[model samples]
Target: MNYNESLEKLLSLTDSERVSGRGQHTRRYDLTRMRVLLDELGNPHLNTPTVHITGTKGKGSTAALIASVLSSQGYKPGLFTSPHLHTFRERINFDGEPITADEFAALIEDIWPVLTSINHDGSHGFITTFELLTAMAFLHFERKKAGFQIVEVGLGGSLDSTNVVQPQVCVFTSISLDHTAILGDTEEKIARDKSGIIKDGCVVVTSPQQPQVMNVIAQACQDHGTAFVQSSEECTCTLSSADLYGQNFDIVAPWGEFSFRTPLLGAHQLENATTALVTLQVLNELGFTVTSDSFARGFRSVQWPGRLEVLSEDPLLIIDGAHNPHSIGKLKEALHDYFQFRRVVYVLGFSSDKNISAMIQELPYDNAEVVVTRSRHPRSASVETLASEFSRLGVSVKQLDTVNEAVQYAMDLAQPDDLIAVTGSLFVVAEAREFLLNIPPELYPSLDAGMPIR
Candidate 1:
């Protein structure tokens, strides 16, 4: 079968959403079926060294940075992430390229019959689409002879499908209040869930998380007898987020102090870069030597989209996937910290389960105009619902049915110095970016290309 046809067939065979629904029921919290499926595929995950990353916000960026550093260190790395902005193949990468059509075809041919046989029997061995995809990734990376595999948790860590791998190093970026429905609303509860990836004798690395969250991780490390490394105080970096390209004032690390610059704008990204640096340092201490030159080369080349990405030049169209209250708070702070505007225009959309009102409240829109919109997702909250919420907040909102319409409306009101920020859901930001920048979603290869996987 062709690539798209094969993916369609696999997606149709089982409910893809069930893969990410583990947090709903403990009965479904086991990985036996996925393990068996991988065994049938020759247990590819066991063939490669692995790094597992789990966190509320920075997991994607952290995984990308680590994989990039590994590539710079002359290792062929494989990266697997989630919720592709364009194609399903984006979830898997080999040597920094999205799996080709021929590769996807070969992978599906190998796994499809096995999945069919398991489903035909009366066994409770059903695997979700994400699990199947994860299995496919293991098979792909193993076939490509990867030096290392960087895996990002699809959801909260404890029962996430990607947790099946025993990682060489387990890294948690930061714990936040997102996914409260599944992981509980408290920071402690969420921290406990993220700490589930720590195994005995493994090295644990973390950024400067909240005090409560840090305590949870520390307790987990002690309980598991794992070596835990927090961000070094001297590894701090200062960030200057100007309207144009931002400058990262990098401080000295275990290797040494050095400043690096990138197009990534925002203070949160600076923190993320530090988290990646500390994690790499832990990896080095574990005998994986990544030199300062390799680190600098990778840091400058790493590209993580849909996070404070600037798409246009004149009016400065910014895109961020700030779906939760904590991330939105950071987004608001970045907006106020970097640029001053006569009037700001916000094009926002969110999922039905998200804290829409809370996120909207956190947005720094004192003198700004808000345009509410809905993205192309099954769970997208209606524009009217957002309009009503903003109305209750005593903020006038303009309603648009889609991100494209909302963005155009915002641009119409934008002046030369005015700024337009599109945020709320990654789905929304993805759609807005495709429209405003005219980058066809299908043309952007995959999430794997963004990571230097393999």
Candidate 2:
């Protein structure tokens, strides 16, 4: 099959990423099924030096940073992340560029027969769409002869499809209460689920987390006989200055002290940078050639889109995918620290399953004008639902049916000194970005280009 044909067949399968409601819990997320599928595919995930990362937030950014460092160290690194904002090919990249359309289609075609056979057999149960994508990524990385592959966990780490590989180094970003209905309601419960990525005898790196959450991760490392390293204890970051464009900071790590200026915003990113730096340090100890100069070059050049991304300067538009309360709180703090504005305009959208009430409370909407809208995503919450939630919070809200409409309305109302923030969901931020940046579908070669995944 061709690229478009293969994409159609892939979309025809059941995609849990686009599904909503508690029924998601009923679907099996078994790693055994994933293992069987990979085994049938010749176990492509094995014998690869991998860096596995998982957490509630900042894991994607951390993975991107690690891949950047590996690339700087003269290694061909493959990066696999999830829930692409603009294109499906964004989920898979080698040496900072997305896999070409032909490459993606070739991988899909290569795995089609095995996927069909597994579905036809009853004992193996049907594999998830994500599982197929994971298998395809492993095969693509191995075929391309990547020096290292950086994999990010899709959901809870234990039963996640990407858990099949034994990583050379494991990194965990901050853990928080997200996916509560599926994972658990408390931080400790969620931490236990994330700690599942810790493998026996591997070195695990983490950012500073809550004491309870830290205890859970530490206990998991002990159980697996893995060495745990905390970024906060091993390194310290002091922010010298920050603005909407980026931030400058000094990191004192075990190797030595280094200063970095990054286009990625927020003080929270300091933790992510530290986590990536420490992971690179661990890789160096494992006989890798990453040096402080590599860290310096990579840390400054990494690009993680849609997380505190500043798109425009005239009206000061910032788009972030802060879907949950914990992330929204960080977004609010970043906004306060980065920009000086006369007024703030919040263009908000969220999925139906998100804690809309709690997320709204965390947003800095006390003195800001709120515009509620829905993205093109199937699971996006309705404008009426969001408007009602805003009203309940004693905030006046303007309801718009689509993300583009909301962003245009905010722009029309804002002054040059006012800030316009498109947030609450990555889907919403994706739409706003396309509209504001005037990106055309032709910009990406994939047939499914400019389409939001999940």
User: Which predicted model would earn the best TM-score?
Assistant: 2
Q: Which window of 10 residues has the lowest lDDT sum in candidate 1? A: 445-454
Candidate 2 segments whose C-alpha is farther than 4 A from its true place: 20-26, 441-452
lDDT of 2 by residue, 1-454 (tens): 7777667656656567865331222356677778888998889898579999999999999999999988888898999999887777788898899988899899989898888887778475676667778988899899989999999999989888899999989888999989998789999999998888889868999989999999999999999999899999999999998877788999997679999888889988988998998999998888988988888888889999899999988888999999999999999998888889888999999999888999999976656999999987768899999988988878899999988899999999999889999999988988887888886422222213333454
Colliding pairs, model 1:
77-453, 77-454, 78-454, 90-447, 95-453, 95-454, 252-257
Q: Model 1, residue 33: displacement in angstroms?
A: 1.0
lDDT of 2 at 442: 24
lDDT of 1: 0.79
Residue-level lDDT for 321 in candidate 1: 86
TM-scores across all candidates? 0.92, 0.96
State the displacement of the C-alpha of residue 134, model 1, in Å, after optimal TM-score superposition: 0.8
**What ranges in model 1 sit over 4 Å off?**
13-27, 232-234, 240-243, 441-454
| Cα shift from native, residue 218, model 1 (Å) | 1.2
Clashes of each: 7, 0
Residue-wise C-alpha lDDT for candidate 1, range 267-313, written one tens digit per residue: 77777778788877777777888887887777777767888888886
TM match of model 2 to true structure: 0.96
